[model samples]
Target chain A: MTANRPLILLTNDDGIHAEGIRYLTIAMEHVGEYWVVAPEAEQSAVGHSITLYDPIKAHEISKNGSFYGYGISGTPADSVKLAIHSLLPRVPDLVISGINNGANVGINVLYSGTVSAATEAAILGVPAMAVSLAQKKNPPFQWVVPHVERLALWLLKFGLPPGVALNVNIPAIPPEALRGYKLTRQRLAKMRESFEEREDPRGNRYYWLSGEVPIEESDDSLDATALNDGFVSITPLFYDLTAHSHLQDLATALKNLT
Target chain B: MTANRPLILLTNDDGIHAEGIRYLTIAMEHVGEYWVVAPEAEQSAVGHSITLYDPIKAHEISKNGSFYGYGISGTPADSVKLAIHSLLPRVPDLVISGINNGANVGINVLYSGTVSAATEAAILGVPAMAVSLAQKKNPPFQWVVPHVERLALWLLKFGLPPGVALNVNIPAIPPEALRGYKLTRQRLAKMRESFEEREDPRGNRYYWLSGEVPIEESDDSLDATALNDGFVSITPLFYDLTAHSHLQDLATALKNLT
Candidate 1:
């Protein structure tokens, strides 16, 4: 590896002013020269969306240039695409998305903009990692930062396989109580659907979408299972959605249709 | 299967007013009892996004009692969630998303709202299908609807496996010129990224994200590859994003960290 410092591109779904990004920036301060580009508003569940119809406005937010940061009026995926395609000084060595609020475990990853930003980078042939706290509220970043920093350094040193990005979720407990990191697969925990019907001021009916997350307590060492057990979960995620095992059966089924 | 009509919930990424959804509604009228709840505006490329922080507005747009449709002020995934949670009579027997204006093939499926809607239904243990045309401009749905109807009927007769959704991309060409369907995998197609910089009336600089899709030709029979060969592609997509092959390697890599 070159002696030169790596160029790290940082982004998140919780908006530019989120506490998670601030803590994440502080953690990466000593490791490499980094640039931060994130959405201006919270885009939490906006999974892999790119803003195509609207013009993107990117405003420089950093004053002293300690970390060149820009707040963009777009989705998390849009920020990553814009930063890598137009803003960065070359392709970044690494892309880190989030110190996100709440755990992106199991089926939640499919709806996570935090992981989507990292996935976008990985699809473009960059090494990427997405980190999340296992709570809805702010967790103790002091303990989480060191683990993230250590993982970042290791990734920079060893390098990740192409087309794969790590989805890391840290438990929201004290360092002493935490069980460290465990590499796991995505579990099947899903948010149960609940809608609240309400009448708007204009006398029109509207519905608010809300849900409760069901606990998945299978014996498998999946991300949700690990996080539920108070263990930090790290899952390697891929962009390939093809169900390879079912290809033959699907082919046979289509043959009958023809 | 019950002698009663199957309840089919319909939605799309192109909003409730798009021609694609209208055509799909007409086609579905013959097959089952239908209910439509879609976004109020186009929500293309929005993958699996659900509106969590904002209050959603769902308004009934259709007066015809035979066809019930609601226009939602949220993403496609949100519409699906709202419909299932509050709008539908019960859990829908099947969910059909899109006759989207353009094809959602290969890795593009990762960023597609059309496919994500189907993925949401599949995740909820319902049979689902996401259909799209290979055209960019105003597509001729007359030719495409027959194939869609046939496929939809076949799927209803022989249900899909749980947790799997079929992503069908029909060639834009006439039905006569089209070859039979091919059960394919997701291919990696290169979309060139370039920004168009322009000054607004206020002299503020902004960018429009623009890119060209490169011709993707792969030996493996993937969705995009099949489309390029003038064949209809039927890819069985799953919501599981875990890279199963890399789990062991990641486990070994993180063993010491714990």
Candidate 2:
């Protein structure tokens, strides 16, 4: 999975210490000159948010006495922005986020810090991609490493359009059991959430948000479905929020507004 | 602006106490039955994030000896989620977010907490709209009151397709100076950001993100342009991130992947 030596910026929502990023950093070394500017702590689910109200601080971090990169006190978007505009010696040729702990597919991608990191770069006119293991807990990330490298290399070679990124999810199966890649689209789906109401030691009642099950959307060509079927699902994603299909009709509808 | 008294869930990113929501809540009374479930403190730029790690807490609030609605210690998305799931007795007919402190036009909508609230409701199968004042400070939200009521009524009458939300931006002008409305698209624009390097009292160096100038994308039909021209800009936004245009091309490019 190793090739061109273009500079790459590596970051994740799982903080600088998560196993997903550490392995990803090691794998990226063969692909390019890589730098890691991730959050000092876990910043999961902090979508496309940036730190505007507070001062952002970052410093060099080392793993086992070897220089890894910088760890910042912010979200995934902040890390990427800070890296591109301030930290890195030069703007990287590509930005790759995660090897996230779980998949960012369907409507749930709206809350994904990993995907948002890549989305940030794409908005900044950089080619980017996000990799995730389909499993949520104790995902065997090693099974997805080579596949990640392969796709990342492909992104460098294939050069995505501006404001576009690939949201890639690999099925959490063993290497031998892994199927090939499948290009897919985000599913029209809903995540069923349940809150656990509890009383604290101080006698205050609180709610912990839990239980997200992807409910419907039975499209075989969709990202979630492709992942469920053991393929490396690559969904080409963009952030042009305009509902172009509804634009003209809406214009006509609102034409007579006072 | 008064019409059918539909049940509307009102929320904002600027906290419940902001003049924007206070005015919005009061204005909503003429249009429908409203319940304001919003963040206890300002939650600007907190995209679609929800509180998962911490237990969310919400309680009733009142203004001028009158009962308001619930305010929660969470993001705008969290407020909407908790409102829909646990706070409200039944699902609301429509959800309206903001009368935000600043314009959420162009690509900036991706990081807007106000828009995210409406987006969360839209994802949950409820019709939603987000209203933003083009001014960043001391915006005369009263100028927006009738227009907001108007468009909101239009939304109820001419319902949006599922997974879609209207991002509305009102020009920061007086009633007499206000131009009419325009149906616009989100501008493909970049916000030129500058970070200020500063020294703390303790002599530590940090960077504070400060400048954000919307640069380029000279499209007359864009939301930013319309607002700048003293018109109300209504943009139909849906968060299906799939890059459908590039899907087939990407599949062909990756067909021979090993």
Model number with the top lDDT: 2
User: Can you write out model 1's per-residue Cα lDDT over B100-147, one digit (the tens) per residue?
Assistant: 988899778988999999999988888899999988897987777887
Candidate 1 to truth, TM: 0.96
TM per prediction: 0.96, 0.96
| Candidate 2 stretches greater than 4 Å from native | A1-4, A201-203, B1-4, B201-203
Residue clash pairs of candidate 1: none
Best by DockQ: 1
Real contacts retained, model 2: 0.73
* lDDT per residue as tens, model 2, B1-258: 124458889999999888898778767767788999999999999888977778899878998898898889999999889988888877888899998988999888999999999889889888899999988878988888888778777777778888889999998888898788888999877789867877779886678887788896667799999899888888988889899999888888887566
CAPRI category for model 2:
medium
Considering only N, C-alpha and C atoms within 3 Å, which residue pairs clash in candidate 2? none
> Total clashing residue pairs per candidate?
0, 0
Lowest lDDT 10-mer window, candidate 1 chain B?
A: B211-220
RMSD of each: 1.9, 2.1
Which 10-residue window in model 2 chain A sums to the lowest lDDT?
Answer: A1-10
